[model samples]
Target: MKNQVTTIYKQAERFAEITKSAIVSGNIVRAKKCLALAERLFATGSYETKNAISNVYVFSVSTFMELRHCNISNLFPQSLKAEYLKQINTSGV
Candidate 1:
């Protein structure tokens, strides 16, 4: 379980990095896809792993929000939006 969580965390981090690169290249679709994969990986981890990846997730989401120009409210997945909202509420951001 620990190894699996660690693997997931590493994969999420890699996806987060890929997401940043995609955003820099102005590839919103690729960035969104990577962010979604990262979020799903984050969700599968244990509490400790989730906490460790929370910053990465937050960074990825905020970067996406800033780079995306379309109607993101409709385009963003509800699950990820909910997670973002929950993080904001909890962190008082």
Candidate 2:
């Protein structure tokens, strides 16, 4: 469990970095892909690791959306977010 948590945390960190770059480069597709992967990985981490990664993911994406004059809340529709989380966690993709 400890090793898995550490591994997931590190992978999520790298994904968050790529996500930030994608956001800056205007590569929304890549950003979303990485974010989705991170979300999937979020399923297996320890509670603290999950919260840290969640903060990074939310802040990175929300900031990008804010800069684009988008409503941060629109980043993910509540229903869609729930559905995707369910699907990704189950699919283990």
Candidate 3:
């Protein structure tokens, strides 16, 4: 039981790390315009456009969808959101 608890804690820590990395490395604009653009692309973009975003961030379709869902989950607090927003805005994304 102790081992299981420790393993679960480690997994949660790793998940938090990955979540931080994802927020750091992507242009996470969850605004209406960005969502609309994403919606339009998913609706009608070419395969190449579907293949990559700015040729830097790439995820399998369902993986990206899951990522989006996780980002908007209650796990993302205002402080983290503010930090991520500041980061991307400063980087001029």
The 0-to-1 C-alpha lDDT of every candidate, in the order given, reads 0.62, 0.59, 0.40
Instruction: Please give the range of 10 consecutive residues that has the lowest summed lDDT in model 1.
Output: 68-77
When summed lDDT is taken over every stretch of 10 residues in candidate 3, the lowest stretch is: 53-62
Top candidate by lDDT: 1
* lDDT of candidate 2 at residue 81, scale 0 to 100: 54
lDDT of 3: 0.40
The ten-residue window of minimal lDDT in model 2 covers 71-80
Q: On a 0 to 1 TM-score scale, where does candidate 2 land against the true structure?
A: 0.52
What lDDT score is found at residue 71 in candidate 3?
48
Candidate 1 C-alpha lDDT tens digits along 14-76: 656776677678797987776566566567867865664576655565556666653445535
Write one digit per residue (lDDT tens) for candidate 2, span 1-93: 653535554665665677778877978788667666666556666787666566555555555566778543444535335543543366544
For every candidate in turn, the CA RMSD to the true structure comes to: 5.5, 9.4, 16.4
Across residues 11-41, which tens digit of lDDT does each residue of candidate 3 receive?
A: 4334334434545566454432343444454
lDDT of 1 at 16: 65
What is the lDDT for 26 in model 2? 77
